[model samples]
Target chain A: MGFLGYRRPDGSVGIRNYVAVMSSVSCANGVVNALSREMTEIKPIIHTEGCGRGLADIAISTRTLAGLGKNPNVAAILIVGLGCEFIKAPGLADQIKPSQKPVEFLVIQENGGTVKTTRKAIEICGKFLDYADSIKRTDCGWDKLTLGLECGGSDALSGVTANPVIGVAADWLAAQGGTVILAETTEMIGTENILARRAADPAMGEKIKSLIRKQEKLTKDILGPLAGLVISPGNIEGGLSTIQEKALGCIIKAGNSRINELVEYSAAPSKKGLVIMDSPGSDIFQLTGMAASGAQLTLFSTGRGTPAGFPIMPVLKISSNTELFRKMEDDLDLDAGQVLAGKSIEAVGKELVSLMEEVVNGKQTKAEINRQDLLAIHTVGPAF
Target chain B: MQEQINAVLIHPSDNVAVAIREIQPGEAILGLKQKISARQNIPRNHKVALVEISIGAKIIKYGETIGIAIQGIEPGDWVHTHNLKAEEI
Candidate 1:
C-alpha cells in the first residue's frame, strides 16, 4: 500500500508538509511563537527543555531540537535563540543543514530585541514556507513509514482491548516492512521480562531490562520516598491495584512482535522493524520524544481517555472502553472496547490496521482535526 | 452446550470481575454465579463485586488488590473510588 507524502532531501517520506519555527532555548519561545503567528504557513514547535540543564541534559535537548528539524514533516526550519543559552541556535541549525532542508538561525540578542527578532524570523519563515510549499507530494510505499505506539490514561480494558488491538496494527506495519516504535519505559516495569523474551538478541534483552531499572531508579530519585504514592490515586480510581498489574496490561501494546532494537529517547532508529524507545510515561513528553525520533505517526491507546496531540505528527487515539469512546467521541478516533463485549481480538486488530491505512492516506485524526492541546517537556538535569 | 462469555480472570487470586459493558441490575453475567445491579452506573472498564464483602475487605482487580472496601458492598455492586479506598503498600 502507498500514500501520497512529501519526499525529503534525505529520502525520508513526510506525510505532512509544515514550515517549522523552532526555539533553540526556552528564552526564545516567545519570539518563535510570535514569528509563527505572523506567518500563516509557519507552525511553531515549542518545548520546555533548552536551558538550565547540565551537560547530559543539554545534550538531550540539543539532539531533540535537531531531530525536530530532521523530522520529515518539517520541510524547512528556522531556529530562534536568545543568543547565550546552552543549546546554541547556530549549532542546531548546523546539525539540521545536512538534511538538505532549509535551516535558518536568528539570535534574539543579535537581532536587537524580541520585536526585531520576531520580524526577522517571520520574514525568514515566510521564505521557508514558500520553499516548503513548492515541494509536491508523491506516492510512497508503506515501507517508508515509521509508526510510534503509545498508551496513556490506562485502565483494565486498556490491556485487554485497545493496547492489544494497537499491537496488532504494529505487527501489521512491521510485516509490511514499515517501522514501529514502542515507548513509555515506566509502563514496562513488571512486564519487562515478557518483553525481554521477544528481544532479537540477548544484548537487546539485557538493554530492555537495564532501561526499565534506570527508569524506576529515576522515578524514585525524583519523586522521593513518596514516589509510589502517585500511582495509588490513579490506580485506585481506575481499578488497578499494583504497578505490576498496570505494567502487564501496558506491555500488551507492544504486541508479540520481535523487538529489533533499543533506542535512547529521541534517538533515530538506524534500521527498524520493531524498536523500543526509552521514554517516560508522561503522555506529551513521550509523544514528543517519539516525534523527534522520526516517527511519522503515532497510535495512542487510552482507557480512561486523554486528548493530547502533537504539532508535527498525527496522533490517533484509541480507547478500550466503549463508554469512554461515546463520552469522548470528539477526542477519540477508534473504539476497540468491543473486545470486552466478546468481539474477537483478531477482528479488532484487522480493523485497527485498516484505520491506520486510512489515517496515512490523508484522514485527519480527532486530535489533528480539533487542533487539540500539544505540549512537550523533556526530563533533564540542571543547566550548569 | 453454551459458550461461556469470554472474560479474563486477570489472576487466579481475585474474586471480582470487571464489567466490560453496562450490566444492568439483576442481569446475570456470563461465566460468574452472581447477578449484577446498576449500583452506580458501572460504565465500561469499571469493576463489580463478585462476592458480598464487609467494610475493609480488599478489592481485587487484574488479580492484584487495587483498593479496600470503604463500606459494606453487596455482590453485583459497583466498586469505585466512592466505595473503595487505596491503601499504602
Candidate 2:
C-alpha cells in the first residue's frame, strides 16, 4: 500500500497542498493573519523578527522565511512585507523561485497601506490556491516520506512506551529509505556519547559530540544552575528528573537508527536516514524548524499532551498512556499506551505506520481537524 | 507467560523499575523473586529501586546510569529528586 501525495517541481513530495501567506517582518503580520482567516487553504507564517537586528539574526530570519516557502507541503507562496524591513519580500520570493512554484509579494508601505496590501495579497493567494488545486495527488513511494520525530510533556512512560514505540516506526521508515529527522539539541546533552557513537564516521561522531558540548555550555553560561532544571515541572511530576533522564527518553524517539548527518536549524537534509536537526527544545519552535526543513508531517509523542500542530502539515500525536489518550481523544491520533498494556513495540509501531499512510492519503489528524495550526521559528542573536 | 504487570524492568540489567500504576506502601510487588515490598508510596510512572543502593552508587534505568544516589536507597524506595541526584546536583 502506498500514500497519495503531490510531487513538486523540486522532486519533493508533499502530503498537503497549501498556499503559504507569510510576513517578511513583524510589521506585515496583520495582513498575513487577515488573509489566512479568509481562506482555509492559505497558511499564515507570522514571526516577530525580520528587521533591525544583528547580521546573524537577520540571516537566520531570512533563511527561515525562505525555508518556510520552500517546504514541499507549500504549493505556492505570497510574501507580505513592510517596505523598509531588512528581509525584503521580493528577495525572499526570489529565494524560493528555484523550486519553480508560483510566488508573489506585496509591500504594505509600497502599496497604499495595510488595507490595500491585504486586498492585493488575497487576490494573489486566490490565484495560487486555484493553481494548487489543479495539481493532482499521485500514489508515491515510501522513500518519498520525510518524517520529523518530537516528544513533549514527556513522562517515564514516554521513554518506556511512546518514544521507543515511535522509535520503531522511525526506524521502519528509515529502513524503507525514508528520511527521519530528530531534533531538540538541548535534549542531546546527556546522551551525546551514545548518539555520537552511532554517527556514520568518526568526524561525524566528533561533530555530534562537539555540538552537544557547545549547546550544554551555552545553556549553562546563560542560565547558571537553572540550566540543570531543563526538564519541565510536568516532566518531574510525571517522574523525570534532571536533564539526563529527559534526554535519555527524548533520544529514544529517534529510534535505534544510525545518525546519517547533522543539519542546522530549518535546513533541509541532503541525505536520508536518521538526520539530526539542531533545534531548541520548545515544541512549536522545533515543529516549525522541521516543517521548514521539508518534513511532510510529524510524529509527536506526548505524555502530558499538547494541542499544537504546524501551519502547513499534519502533526500525528501519540499518547504515552491509555489515560491521556482517553482524555485527549480529540487532540491525539495514535495510542502507544497499548505497549504499556502488554502489546509489543513492533505492533504499535506497525499501527503507527498505517496511521501515517492514512494521514498522507488526505486524512486529517485531530490537531489538523481542530485547526491547531501553530508556528514559530528559532531565532539566534539579539535584535538591535 | 504474563502476570499482572504493575512495574516494568525496562532492561534485563536494570536495577530499577518504573511503576506502571501507583503501588501503595507495603504492597508486595508480584512477579518478582525475593518478594520485594513497596517501602513507600510509589506513584505511577515513577522509578523504584529494585535493589539496595549505597550512596554515590549509580541509579540505573533503561540499562544506563541516569543519576547517582544522594542517599542510601533500599529496594522499592521511590527514586526521585530527593534520594537520587541526577548526577551529583
| Candidate that scores best on DockQ | 2
> Which of the CAPRI classes, incorrect, acceptable, medium or high, describes model 2?
acceptable
Clashing pairs in 2: none
CA lDDT, candidate 1, residue A208: 88
Q: Which pairs clash in the backbone of model 1?
A: A52-A383, A53-A382, A53-A383, A54-A382, A241-B66, B25-B37
TM-score of each: 0.80, 0.86
lDDT of 2 at A354: 86
lDDT per residue (tens digit) for residues A224-307 in model 2: 867655677887898886667778777878877899999999888999999999999899989988888889989999989999
Measured with C-alpha atoms, the lDDT of residue B81 in candidate 2 is 94
Please give the RMSD of candidate 2 to the true structure.
Answer: 3.8
Worst 10 residues of 2 chain A by lDDT: A223-232
CAPRI class of candidate 1: incorrect
Off by over 4 Å in 1: A224-245, B1-89
- Fnat for each predicted structure, in order: 0.21, 0.39
